[model samples]
Target: MSGTLHLAQALSNRRRRGRKKDFRDAERLVKRLVSQELTLSFVPDGEHRLWRTLTRTRYQRTRDKVRLQNQLEALLEEAHINLSSLVSDLLGASARRRCMR
Candidate 1:
């Protein structure tokens, strides 16, 4: 799919008009790949793919952790519980016991 638009444009007979979006998308992909901003492969590379998957998973988990921390902080605020002000880790043993009660 890389450089698909450029190839399509270059190969087009010009006997018919094609969708603008298609050409635009292809152009974007080509530019990104050419600029090395985007990485792609037509053949499967197991180790590379796995590394990519692992990084993506780690990123998603980090985002989830941040979201949960924000929600927890908001809930504590709503309940007038200022655990964060007292402890560095609000979900740690000390804060958890207070929250449970």
Candidate 2:
């Protein structure tokens, strides 16, 4: 029973080490890919051209345009606009006070 338990622990330790090595290798691959950057290329084959045309037509429709516009409007609604009026007022007041001195 003791020997079996020791063997099981050894197996678990080996599995853990193997998983750690695999994770390190994956991290290295990701870092290399990120450093090199990435791009998508569409080769102008017959099938690719057909798919591209279909995609473009789908996106160019009025309904898709309306949907995209609505999405943009909703996103802009959630964004905060920072006005420069207050900042300009403060700077102008400081400059005027400095000039008077």
Highest TM-score: give the candidate number.
Answer: 1
The parts of candidate 1 lying over 4 Å away from their true place are 1-44
TM, every model: 0.54, 0.22
1-101 per-residue lDDT for model 2 (tens digits): 35211111222222323445777755654554456432323347689889999988987886777777566545644664222322343235664564366
Question: What tens digits encode model 1's per-residue C-alpha lDDT throughout 11-98?
Answer: 3223235666777766766666577655343544689889989999999999999899989999989999788998788768988877
True lDDT of residue 81, candidate 2:
21
- Model 2 CA deviation exceeding 4 Å by range: 1-42, 62-101
Question: What lDDT does model 2 reach?
Answer: 0.50
Error of 1 at 27 (Å): 21
Q: Which pairs in model 1 have colliding backbones?
A: none
Instruction: Give the worst 10-residue stretch by lDDT in candidate 2.
Output: 3-12
